[model samples]
Target: MHITLIVPTNGRPSLVSRLLAHLERQTLHPDHVIVSATTPNDIEVRPDISFKVSYVFGDPGLCAQRNRAMALCDGTTDIISFFDDDFVPCDSYLETLSRVFREHPVYAVVTGDLLADGAQGPGLGFDEAVAMLDAYRPSSLPAHVRDHPGAYGCNMSIRAQVIGDLRFDERLPLYGWQEDIDFTSQLRAHGRIVNIGQLWGVHLGAKGGRVNGVRLGYSQIVNPIYLIGKGTMQRWFGIRLICRNLVANTLKSLRPEPYIDRRGRLKGNMIGFAHVLTRRADPEHILKL
Candidate 1:
């Protein structure tokens, strides 16, 4: 299968470097790897890498950058896989993905199990991440592959032929919250979207190169409402999401946790909820926050 990998990043060169190293050890390699950044110089490429690497630049939003990278793919590319710059895949990651797609012709999208920092908590160190990848192995069988509602943007792959000309919603703006659900939900019309437990990976959950807690918190509320208004999300689902985030942020803010901005997120969620109550909620308000 002719597969291409796309990673959209913003000033996270060191993390990208580690991801490249993991790619080198993959049992199945991509025909091409596209690294999309805010500027061409933000990425430093290693000439010793075996696969073909391409560096491209675009606006900083994740959705916009990914779309730019997808446009650069060769027309014949069969599958396009999206991986967050902070994700560290197991050695058999690509091999497992390729096998699922090859075996299930009707599968339109596959989302891998995204573990939190290799079973370690947040702020995962580089050496620890590499070590975890080195020692990883598949722990389950065919039962691991099952139907899912949507793809997880951190680690998901789509069949290029099946999702022709589709791109992420730029209106979702920075961090592009729920962009994965919005995009993958559209693909369900074409075929099944499944979660492959054996194709697991760890998300470093690095806080850098991301929007502030306020903006993310705003997205947590506004994005869902916007989708619901657009008919992309069910009203019940949107309400549940709003209530859950509000309650979590409210409760957690009284005593903030390490590596999390409980207070800031609570404030943002309250602001968004107020807007919604006043009938003035807008997704664009996230930028203003």
Candidate 2:
């Protein structure tokens, strides 16, 4: 299969370099690997290998970068897979991924286990962590939950046709959160998205909420609003739905796990509330990509 792997990173040159090394060793090498970098210097490694790899310079926003990366794959590419800068694909990652996509002919999008690599491996498991956003697990409720499709941009694959000119919704770019949720939701609107049973992408880094604490919180709280405005919230969140999610997240936050910090989330919820009440109509204050 003519597969194109898309990676978008802002300033993590080292991670991208390591990922390129891992890609060089992949048993089934990608036909192409497209990277959207904040600057040209982000891609420091180019292994002497047979697989096609391309790099493009872009500004620092998750969805926008991803959009630029996808542009590299026009109509000819079979599957466009996305990985975060920190991900290191397992040996059989691409090989098994191909099998998953071919196995599920009715599904336009295919995603699988995103195991954490190094010290940041997902202790909660991919299913639990992926559930934090929105996704389709075969054993769960259903393959496609609603007309909206949800996917994990970090390790997700979509058939080019199912998603026409769709790009990451740039408006909710705060801390790069919720963009994938919105993207996946949109995909689900057209066709089903399936989760591969064993395909895995190892994420190498933990949540970098330490750098932009307030903004990280802001993105967390406000992304749902932007998502809802786009009609991608699954219509499952009215006042009651919002309350449920907030309470659930709040409870999850109190766990004090350094990985998922709840203190920033509480502060972010406050900022989010302020924006939702007094700043929703304002352009600068509210989250917009």
Q: Pick the candidate with the highest lDDT.
A: 1
Q: Write the per-residue lDDT of candidate 2 for residues 168-209, one digit (tens) a residue.
A: 767655346766777876777556776655665655554442
- TM-score per model over all chains: 0.94, 0.78
lDDT of each: 0.83, 0.66
Looking at model 2, residue 2 earns an lDDT score of: 73
Q: How accurate is candidate 1 locally (lDDT)?
A: 0.83
Model 1: CA > 4 A from native: 117-121
Candidate 1 versus truth, CA RMSD in Å, comes to 1.9
Alpha-carbon RMSD, each predicted model: 1.9, 6.1
